[model samples]
Each structure stands twice: as structure tokens, then as C-alpha cells.
Target: MRKEPLLLLILIALILAPSVQGAKKVVYVAKVEGTITEYTADQFQRYIDIAERNNAEALIIELNTPGGLGDAMMRIVSEIQNSSVPVIIYVYPRGAIAASAGTYIAMGSHLIAMAPATSIGACEPILGYSQNGSIVRAPEKIRNFYTAYMRSLAEESGRNTTAAVKFVTEDLSLTPEEALKAHVIEVVADDVPDLLRKANGMRTKLPVKGKGYVVLDFTDVQVRHIGNSISDVLISYLSNPAIAYILLNVGILGLIFGFLTPGWHVPETVGAILLVLGVVGLGYFGYNTAGVILIILAMIFFIAEALTPTFGLFTVAGVASFIMGSLLLFGKGGGSIYLINRETFSMLRIAIIVLAVLLGLFFLFGMTAVVRARRRKPETGKEEMIGAVGKVVEDLDPEGVVKVRGELWKAVSKTGEIIRVGETVKVTGMRGLTLIVEKAEGDAEWQE
Candidate 1:
């Protein structure tokens, strides 16, 4: 009986030990919506780190974006390519687009899935302008180089090379069903659970260092979401063309206001913070150096116009330069390309032109007023009569009163020329409440 009890205990121990030794499988889902900026890159890196730390089975990135910066896209692609865990790109929730840079990211992923109503493609290098604002196009050579790079990524990911080329060269797009049929994507699913079901038992070749290839078996997986932090979300939104432009304008206007009227530190502080944020956002969007230089030149012109009267020339030139610079500020990347929208640019141009004209008029009037004030006669005490040419209003015994510009003032004569009432004289100096006068050379007839 004791031997039987011992055998039963051993059986239970063996079953429990196997259960304890087997690890629970997990699937990490990361959602990327909107423009993929530097914050997106940071978040992706963070999620990758998290996956690595937890030894997750795979990382699924649900991507919904119009596109973003080229450099950021390249960084993301590099990260995806180098990731040890299987990275799946899924375009979800229907009506979402994976244009430009998004195409590169999806192609870079180890596995790509799409929602039934979603579409992808349009990997063509748009040279200038975006849905958000205007952007300068890359040089032809550079664009070709990026095209070749994306092609290589497609090849590595086992996507259709011909279709990939068409995407870059012709801006071809594909719906989920079409993408699957063309081999641009692996599968189509309604949601994450369905994705997990379809993804389960799927095998992928891992790029392990020493091993030739390790197969991924994502069976019986636990799903863990990797959502963006509030800061990350804010950064991503602020990196948009519209938001960036607003921030840039606010920062510049605040700074100008602060400079014009000192002692209000709040505008300056806000301006400094906004300027930093705008610059960082522009950098994240891959702005050209020339565009930035042009913007600086525009600001210089604006300040110059404010300080010196340029007859509206500097103001006009500044507005023109600013519009052009803003139009060419950012560039298109593999995923998201930043460009100024046509309507926005047109409105901005009009506003800038109007502002310039108004400022020019204000400076013109203000400068004229200042010149007039400088030429006007002094209105204060005795010093006001120093250079005045006036007539004696009363007979003076070397000291009396005089009339100057319709005002009577106390006066005296330095040269002992007897001054009679109505005798014309010129002011030489003054004593408290008294003006010293000299007989006018050409006004002797008036003294007769």
C-alpha cells in the first residue's frame, strides 16, 4: 500500500514539474497611428526592449499612418530588421492607409497582415508637399537610392519585387485582398484576436547569429498591448505639419512681441519653449537646411524692416521668403512625408502679406512722427527760447518780455541796442524765467 502511494505521488510530481517548466507564450501588440515621428521611433525601440526583456513570442505593430520623415523611417526599418523577435505589421480598423514611409515599415517587418478594408502602397517618393503642408522633394539620385533601398527591404521580407517597384515608381496601392493576392502581405484578418489565430502555427526564418535559421512557433499566445505614453502621443501629434506650423508661428510672434515690449517675461518664456519644440519637431520631420536658412533670413528681414524704414521692400521680401521657406521646409520619407497643404500655404501667404503691409504702414507712420517730434520747437521752460527769433512785446530796460510763436516770454538784451516794443530780436540765452535777446541784423527796419 505504501509503495502504491509513493508511485502515485511521483506521477503527480512529474505532471506538476512539466507544467511548471513550460513557459507561457505572449504576443506583444504595438499600435502606431498617425505620422511616424521621432517619438514613434522611440516608442518602437521601447517596445522592442520590453519584448526582449519579457522574452515575448512576437511583436505586432498595428500601423495606421499617412507617412512620415525619411530618416525616421530608415531608423524604424533598421530597428525592425535588427529585431530578434518576429515583427508583424498589421494595418487595421479599416479605411486606414499605409502610404509612402508606411510601406517601407510594413515591408521591413518579418510578417505583414492587413485588415479587410485597409489598403497599402504609394511608396513613391513624393518630392514636394504633403497632405499637411509643403515639403521639398529629394534629389533624383537620392530618391533613386531610397527606392533601391526599399526594394532591397522588400526582397528581404519576401514581398513581390515587381509590385514593390511599381509602388515606388508608379505609386500603386493595394487593398487587403489585393495585397494578399499580389504577395505584398501575408494575410487578412478582422481584428487582433483573428490575427493571432491566423498568425498562430505560422513559421518565420529568424536571423540568429550562430544558428542558420530559427523557426517561430506562436502557438497558444498571450496578448500584451504596448500603447504609447501621453508624452509620446503628444509629441507625435505636435510633429504634424499643421501643428508644427502653428507652434512655429506662435513662437516667433511671441518672441517678436516680447522684443518689442520688454519686461513681460511670460511671452519670452513661452516663445523659447515653443521655439525649441518647433525646431525639434522640424528636425523629426527631416527639414532641409536650406529651408531653415531661408526661414532665418526671413526673420532677419522682418526685424530689419521693424528697425529701419525699408519703404515696404523688406517686409514684402520677408513675407515672400517665409512663404517659400515654409513650403520647402520638410521632406518625404519611406513612411510619412511632410508637406504643406496647398490651402494652408495659400492662407499663410495671404496672412503674412497682410501682416507685412500693416507693419510697414505702422513703421512708416511711427518714423514720420519721430522725425516731426525731433524738428518741433521745445515747449518747456527757459531753454525753449535759446534759438527763437521773435519780436519784443514791451519796451525793455535790458530786460523785458518778447513774443515767440504767439507766446510771450520774459527777455533781456545782451548787446546794449535799445529794444522798443515790436522790435524784432533773436534769442541768445536765458536766466530763470528770462530770455536774453540780440537785435536781428536784417530786422533793423522793423525797429524804426
Candidate 2:
């Protein structure tokens, strides 16, 4: 009987053990689009942290970007290289690209996948702006650094180092087929489901600091898509070059309008906040000090005009200065090396011209009309006759005629005094067409 009980206990424990130890497969999918910046880096880290905390089988980054700042890219690479969970970078959705900094980030991942028609490469580094406002490549020294960095990523990821080096030097781009053939990418799939199916049980090495590599088993992992949080979406939008530029100018205009119209604290406060944010947006790429100075001078001119009403002279000057300042703002290097293109520059120039012209017209004519209305004297009525003195056209016998203000009027004497035809009379008051006159004193000349 005792032996039977022991056997029963062992059987029950064996049945329960598999259920207790089996872990569910969980894959985290993080979507990355637009220009990579500090916001992107931060959000990427957050995704990884969440995945690791959840004991995820893998973290997949869906990447589609034109590139971004070197610092932000490198930070993202570092985060990926140091992550405990395996990171799979997938260029997805049938026509996405991973260019410039995006190429660097994709290489840093444990595995890279692509959807149909997706592409990669074009890792050349654009250093900064030339004096003529065109982009220039980095120096040989910088080029070498990038070449070696890319080569390292290729070597560490077990991809083609030679081809990767060419990507930096020659700006060699690759289609999905070309990348796979060049050994730059592992595989291509139509969608996430297909990607997971293909990537399952794939062999890959994960980096562990100091210690070499930790092989991860990715067999039968269940994939799950994680949408961006509200903050993530907002940051992504704010990081857009066009949007950031608009915000910056809007802030400047708001502040100027507030200052011009005194006692409007709302616009001023909102403008201050926006200006600060705009500066921060510019900081993401980098700003030219010279450009910033020009913009400040423009603002000064605008403010001076508002305070002293230069009748659009200062306004016109300010507009001109602002256009110049805006042109030079990104002349030095910043985050997105190729962020400002020819089309963007042209659009900005046109916008500045239009805005300046509109503002000039408003201040020049609108404000003038308002001031004139406030100071104009009444042209007709009793107010016009109150202090008039004129010559008596006919002798006034308590009711005679006088010429006042170049117009004839019948006179009624205030003191019934006789006024000669050549004598001047003072208009004391008026009733209808008659002037209430008083005799002019000695040497008093009537001015009609």
C-alpha cells in the first residue's frame, strides 16, 4: 500500500512539471519611421527595456528612415549591441528604405530582414554645408572612421565587410535581392507573419559585454506588434524637419505680435514656450551661430518698428534680415545632414517673401488708417464756428450779414452794437445760418 502511494505521487508530479516550466514565446515589434533623433533613440531603448522585462523571445524593430544625426544613430547602435534580448531589424512595408544612419542601425541588430521592394545601404556621411549652401562630404579622416565603423558592424554581424565599406565610400545602395546576395542581409519576407516563420529557429549570436557571444534559440516564437505610445508619436512628429521649422517660425511671429499688441499676455507666454521648443528642435540637428545671430537681429528690427512706428521701413528691413537668417540657420552642420534639401530651401524662401510682404502691407496701411481715425478733427457743424472772427459784409443792426470762415452768415449782435461793413466781428455763437456776433476790439483783425 505504501509503495502504491509513492508511485501515485511521482506520476502526479510528472504530469504537473511540464505545465509549470513551459514559458510562452513572446516577440516585441517596435515600429520606427521618419528621421532618427534623440526621441527615436529614447523610444527604441524603452521598447527594448520592455521586451527584456517581459522575457521576450526577440525584439523586432520595423525601420523605415532616410537617416538622422550620427550621435543618435550611434546611441541606438550601442543600445542594440548591449541589449540582453536579441534585436531583429526589419525594413518593412514594401517600399521602405534604410539609408545613411539607418544603415548603421540595421547592421547593429542581431538579424536584419526586409519586405518586398525594401532597400538598404547608402551609408555615406555628409559632413556639413559648404559656404555656398550645398552639402559637403566629411573629410578623409572622418570617412576612415565611418568606414571602419561600418566594417566592424558587418564583421560583428557576420555580414559582408567589403561591401559594407563600399557602402560608406561609394554610397552603394542595394535592393532586397542585392542585399541578400551581397550577404548584407539575412532574408526577405512579405510580412511580419512570414518573417517570423522564416526567422524561427535561425542561429544568431548576441553580444555580451566583456564576454564574447551568447547564442539565442529563436524556435517557435510568437510575434506580437506593439504600437507607439502617444508620447512616441508626438515626438516623432516634432522631429520632422518641416514641422519643426514651421513651429520655430510660428513661435517667433507669435512673440512679435504679442509684443506689438501690449497687454496680451497669452500670446507672449505661448510664444515664449514655442520659441524655446523651436530652439530645442533646431538643437536636434545643430544650429549655426551666425544664422541665429541674424535671426535675432531681425527680431530686434521688428521690435524697434513696433515701438517707434517706422511705417513699414523697419518691418521691411526685418523681413529681409529674417530671410537671410533663415537661409544661414542650418549652414553649419546639424542632426539631419541632408535634412534641408533644395526643394525645402526654395519653399522656405518663398514663404518668407510672402509673409514679409503681407506683414508690410498690414502695418503700412492698416495701422496708418487706425491712427488717422483717432486724430482727425470734425469738418462740419457748430464746432467749426465756435471761435471764428470775420469782417462784417453789411452793417449789423442786431441782425446783419458777416463773412466768417469764407462763408456768409446773418449776424445778430450780442450787445445790440452797430457793426460797420468794414469792421471785423467775433462769432460768439450760431443759430441756423445766422452768426451770434460781438463787435471786434481795436486792432483785432478777422481771419476768414
**Residue 296 accuracy (lDDT) in model 2:** 77
Q: Model 1 reaches what TM-score against the true structure?
A: 0.69
- The superposed Cα distance between candidate 1 and the true structure at residue 282, in angstroms, equals 1.3
Report the Cα lDDT for candidate 1. 0.74
Which consecutive 10 residues in model 2 have the weakest lDDT in total? 332-341
**Highest TM-score model number:** 2
Top-lDDT structure, candidate number = 2
What is candidate 2's lDDT per residue for 58-91, written digit by digit as tens? 8889999988789999999999988878888999
lDDT of 1 by residue, 1-448 (tens): 8899999999999989976655688889988888777777887888888987787788888899878767788889888777777788899878888988899889887788999888898877756555455555667897798779878987776779899888887789999989999988887999989987887776552353233344566667788898778887678767765566657766876787688669978887898788778787766655666666676677677667666745567767776777666655653352144454466456645654665456456555654665567669778766765666888888777788888777788888888667999778887888777788888778443321
Q: Against the true structure, what is every candidate's RMSD?
A: 8.8, 8.3
